[model samples]
Target chain A: MTNLPLSVPVAPNRLSLSKFARRSPSAAIGAALVVLILLVALFAPWIAPYDPIAQDIANRLMPPSAAHWFGTDSFGRDLLSRLIYGTRPTLMLLAIVILLTTPVGIAIGIVAGFYGGMVERILMRITDIAMAFPKLVLALAFVAVLGAGLVNGALALALTAWPAYARQTRSETVSLRKSDYLAAAEMMGITGPRLLFGHVLPLVLPGAIVRMALDLGGIILIAAGLGFLGLGVRPPTPEWGAMVADGTQVIFDQWWVAATPGAAILLTSFAFNLLSDGLRDLMDPRNG
Target chain B: MSLVDISDLNVTFRDQDVGRHILRGITVAIEEGETFGLLGPSGCGKSTLLRVIAGLNRDWHGSMSLLGEAVAPRRRFTGKLRRQVQMVFQDPYASLHPRHRIGRALREPLVVNGLDNPDKRVTEALAEVGFGPDVASRYPHQLSGGQRQRIAIARALLLRPKLLLLDEPTSALDMSVQAEILNLLVTLKARFGMSFVLVSHDPDVIGHMCDRAARMAEGRIAATFDRPALAAGAAAAR
Candidate 1:
């Protein structure tokens, strides 16, 4: 006769701030940068020193000074003001691509993988066709047909970006569907949506999150590239890429004009990349 | 009147390259509240037979009935069958969903079957399996092998099923853990008075827990050891 109740109490699932900070320092740094950038993007109007499009002809192409920190572009529009406002469209492009692509891709992938055979063949073939072309070239072509603008460019990027997510989610769903726990859940009467959402989705979602994080840097770069190519926002909108392209006319004489916006793009892209790197390490078990 | 009856059951996997026969013309009957053991070597179809009875594998030709209801092997299990028959998988690590906490895992069957008081039931089930209240909040990875096994058993018992189909339940644990799990199973069996069709390659496990045991070879029942013969054989082997 042995004592039977073998249960032991444990501390609840709460991570102390210091412990979290210590464990994922890189992720913390990445998160801080992302948050700071988001804040700047959100508070552009309130924080910007001058009207972005307001021209001061006398101060044209002035080097970095107290009155005009990033100096003034060829048109004499305040360069710092333009760059601050430019964060809006850049962040908006990220939001649109993520909002449109993530859910659509995840849905198609999960559905195809869960109900393999005919459904998988149909969905994967469509994805393959989308993925066959160089993503930037495909988006460029799409924007050309749709007529160039920020909306068309964003849509093109979204079209190219969704397939990656679908492919990722499909592979994840395929593996998760084969796990014994899924079989057990199915046997216990957990079927259809409940099985897919409850048992399968939870396991696959972390991988998707990590993938989304990794894709952020690339998507941001592509959006800026589209802007630089004149396929994004029309002139006088103060878009960073457009501003940089405008400054290229007097490149040798007014180096600061192009260099300011170019540096902004580099810094923003780096912030996203660092954040993605930290997310990959934190979210992906293989990396961790 | 037997609690479970299966006659001339056959199972095969139809692969594009090769069709492999798994279970061939197997027949067995188990009474209510009886502990039935299936002893065999690997690829002997003992586990397959247990799965069929649990209604997990439906792609088979079989006439089977459990607790007076005809057992149908379909992708989805009927709620009545779900409430009456539950299964415990061999690999404790793989049996429970890795992402789910112990509490959620235990509550799932109850919620699926529309049983009331999941909060109370989860606590009771954990206590019945000799688990502490705090164990529910922890993931499977947080617990030891034996503790996970106990959680799996606790999960099965949450539904208060009449028959538990266990496939090599203790084979994955250490010798000490194995003994403790086996003892726990024995204690729980007596307490609940539910039927068990325990499948294992270990003969000593069969001799210890089962009142009547069958030996399977190549998808067929090769021999059976009744209660008295099993006791005598244990003595003789010792």
Candidate 2:
């Protein structure tokens, strides 16, 4: 190698959490809410003052008071305890759906994008058909055929949700396929799997992650919707949506039972949505 | 013996219908260690020809031989061919992977070519391109236009290719940076003793760096000229 000046000692900026929080306080807040929810879910047995499913027929449908902070449900189950325990199944379903869908969708998208023409046409058309169906309706139909359970509900939701990731990632891959860096890589005799995993995947992944983050809240809501419809996790389980569904019966007489779970769902879902927005802003290079 | 010998090269968008010809029966030759310039306007197939030599466009009717060996269009380039030829793209901004550090970008070619000790090679190559160890850690976006181009060149040279195919390497840069890059390329060429097929629209660039030059128009080589020994004489006199 020819000699040239080693003039500069570069110290590039490191991305620290505090820096990120300062840049996007909304994301920070969202993350804090999510962490709080996770902590409550993890420590539900310890944190919850009462057993979620222990029926006290005498205390049934009581209004909010210090003795019963969120009052009692129609079944006389503690509303606060049930709300805390409910976070577990909601988050569990979300985790399962994400695990099942993200890889499947990303794989399909990469294949469709890398090999255009007949493969792309066929894959995209299938995705289009899947995407056209209302996600909840499609999940309901799947549950109708498969029978109702947490696993079935998760499977159904994953099946319906995968198309969004597939379509989004496919479009991302399609655009990046024509990238000059890829063309440069091709010229350097870097083709096939190495080119795909090393080059294309890295470029396509951040966008997919942003989309996944945005979709997380929707996934949680859908899981809850499935539970509320009596198609998720079965009865006797202390799930938020099921709790809300149970409380809906005595609406005017006692609002605390339904309101507690409903508020929990609203707050958590809102936190997720805000987190996604914050994440989008944080990850976006243009924002920086 | 010619380093690049392409003959009767005919590239069309569609072979079935005699579709629009991109390169029409074009031929060119360059000697080993010679700086050959392709002077042409935009969309005149100059870049296409360079791409063909770089083994990017395979759908073409041509007999292409580098260092006197025929190349098959659809086949993977042989290891020797890969190591013997490298290209510096026109747009420096778009050429380097946006997500990768300059060091990784330089190392990839060596790794792909199965070269041993890539870390040492990359460090040495970085220095050759007027970059320090710190530059290696920096992403392409962090660097200036000229620095990015230098990284691209460093990436090309990591494999120590016998021939460098440069497509408008300096045209995108400011006029000041253009001269610096031109000088860098000329110096590197002397040190490496590698041939270059430089494509540019600027005649001054052609006159400054090239030993022999050719003008291209509408997918054909319109004319060829020999400069007075790498323009050193003319540049000095000016």
Candidate 3:
């Protein structure tokens, strides 16, 4: 009595790159762009034609030419070199913010959802309070309190970032908590941390990762905002936001300085947005 | 001592200001190695009763004993009590973790219980469920409905549970696949020498599998049936 459509042909578990590219070309292009940026950041020192900090006053404000591509800053430092070096801090802040936020958010969310009672009330209230505040304002407050630097700016962003993830994951976990698979797990005596980490975490991770990717563009903007506000990494580090700040003074005469770093920021943000959209499509069960 | 003895079981769910009673004063005893069936229509607390026995519904007020040990309300099943009880859920597609491979899903109980030879047990489970070792690497979605149900059964049986609770286990399946799964359960029950508390709306299923049966309605056991009565009822329904 094996009636019900006996064994539908199984699809391969892994998605081939060619198939992914074909399915979501925008994501593919985004991925390629992001990879290129990473490579540029990774090899900044070697790839940059001149010392980013070494100023040549004679060539000051020289526009884009054979001798200097992307022209020179007020200090006559290579704009190309500065832009390349700027990628390091931007990428690092992104890494730090994600690393700090995701686990903390996921843990709080899971614990609250799985154990729903006073625990859920307290955790969700805290999340609500955190979310109620404007994220930029909260980050600004945190940076002001902690003092300005790369780690401090990242910390400030991290403090404001986790609540979104917590709320997202909490909602997901709440629904998953009522799922039959979880009920089956409870029957198997897999309670407490094992159930939370093993059963719940894996199921919730795709949503979290997609959210993280989507949030990356916002994170880059916020980090740049912090840098522009004079609360980011110290000057002469060639941060994109700080360079933009530097370029604003001579923007009327030599607009390339501000525009170059501004373009880099925009491209990075666009890449993340495209990648997140592609990932969302890829992870959607309907698409599958 | 009975394998499962429950008396005066009352399960109430409070939703804000409303209190809904799901199972009211359920009393039943399942003997060792006996296949007892709870036959009922939808909304009759049969599945809730099953969940109570499996320790998934801890909010019930009742006296329950499994394997001669009294179980407390709001307390988790642990050690021997936990290992001896397992449940096959209604939906095969929803019961098994979609992300987990068959081998890992089957082996998890063994690993969590700190049992030895998980790989060996997992292999044996696959074989017992009529699956090849290659099936171990497959995800739940890759399998047919019957195949997934078999895997769910395999996962439940890996612990060698003495009392296996089935909550409309084949209700989600097609007629033919349902029969296949029902027969698989019968064979597995015999092989493992385990007691079963089967819940189903079908009298045919109740008569075919259960040694004794109870007809329940609106959270109450309205009638109990002996084997002959069950058979007669099933025949009449047919």
Candidate 4:
């Protein structure tokens, strides 16, 4: 018998941060912007020039001055400080929603895809019903029932967010179920959860993560919308959507009031979008 | 007793309203420690029959027995039957999981079966396929087609299965690599004393590897060749 070659060249196991940045500049920029926002949120108290909620009637409506950088709102609160504090709730809500939805959605999807037939029909139909309703309307209905607090708002958004993940994961799992590796695993007597979670779940994760990143921007927009409608965090607590609502009243005279928080929301969503696009490109099977 | 026995095996796939008959009444018996070849052209259901024997395709009409135990249609092979039969697929590139390392893939079957000393078993299996210990750390994408096929062979043999079903195992590799893999299979089969049901379109491969071979056309065994006939290249003629 001919001997197989001993020395075969191997691809690098890890992609360094610098290499990743060089490969996809937009993702790098997005990551940097996200890190900056996280830092701002983390050190809001230390970084803010004045207390976010503390009103200084004398400084009310101040515009782009040396003392009040982003100017003061109608409540005479610092717009910059309020924006800084606002980042906290938005990020917190996102984390909560992701934690709640990813596992539930993936589980429902894998079970449906793996079992197929009647289980697939029932689970997918339920996912479809959940998906059929307008996301904002369903979230609004949920908030109306649950009452508006940070966790409740997060819960409402999470309920609407999971169906899309379920659909994405289910479709991926359906195709993966036919793959040769999975079939080989089955032949070895690896069945049930061990096969599904061990063999199937890892293959489906990259796509699901890319989907999650893409969904982040949309989740932020919906969260901000809830805050604008007075169904978010209780009053006097800084929220980007509430701040924009606060800005709209004096938009004609003082555009900075609404503009500052509006700019923050736009930048945050844009960062997530760029990050997701880069991730999708990197994780593409063709690229691998 | 025969290692594998099947009589009148038929497989039909139903899509919506139409039922397509893929395997139409195939009967074959493989003696213990024998290499039986199923030689046929594309779309002749050789791979389907291999899948049936491996228990990967359970939806079939047949009276089948493996190592003397009968198997029912549309039922999963359980316990010893499940572990005794293993299959290596056609494409080397697609057979192994892309994300998993070679070591993990080899250890998986042993781990699943609750066998002890998985690491040692993985090392031994790799060595049996002419691979060194360092090869274990590499991913499937890193390996060449020949290397991947060897790894696939090692994984199937890790369970010490009684019957190994090969679905065009070397068809994906080039000329030189195919010979190496086929030789490797010959040596491994001799060492393990295992029966193999090899499916291929090439008559040369069948004559080289199989002790008793069947030439299939349109899902039926058109001719069966003994050692003398195969040596005379009777399979290639008709």
Highest TM-score model number: 4
- lDDT by residue (A1-288, candidate 3, tens digit) is 222333568789799999999999999999999999999999999999999999999999889999899999999999999999999999999999999999999999999988899999999999988778787787788789888889988987888889988988889999999899998887777888999999999888889999999999999999899889888999888899999999999999999989999999999999999999899889875455
Candidate 4's residue-wise lDDT over A208-256, tens digit each? 8999999999999988998999888988999999999988999999999
- DockQ, cand. 4: 0.72
- Please list all clashing residue pairs in model 4, or write none if there are none: none
| Model no. 2, DockQ | 0.51
Worst 10 residues of 1 chain B by lDDT: B229-238
Instruction: Give the per-residue lDDT digits (tens) of candidate 4, residues B115-232.
Output: 9999999988898999888899999998999999999999999888899999999999999999988988988998998898999999999988889999887888888999899999
Off by over 4 Å in 2: A1-12, B14-18, B229-238
Collision pairs in model 2: none
- Writing each residue's lDDT as its tens digit, candidate 2 over A148-264 gives 888888887888788888888788899888777998887677888888888888877777788888888888888889889999887788888888888889888898788889899
Which number leads on DockQ?
4
lDDT of 3 by residue, B1-238 (tens): 7888889999988979799888889898889998899987899888888888988889989799999999999999999888889999999999999888888888888989998999998888888878777788888888888889988998898888999999999999999889889988998888899999999988888889998888888888888887888777752252
lDDT of 3 at B216: 84
C-alpha local distance difference test of each model: 0.83, 0.84, 0.89, 0.89
The window of 10 residues in a row where model 2 chain B has the poorest summed lDDT is: B229-238
Look at candidate 3 and give me any clashing residue pairs.
none
Question: RMSD in angstroms, all models?
Answer: 2.7, 3.0, 2.2, 1.3
Off by over 4 Å in 3: A1-8, A285-288, B234-238
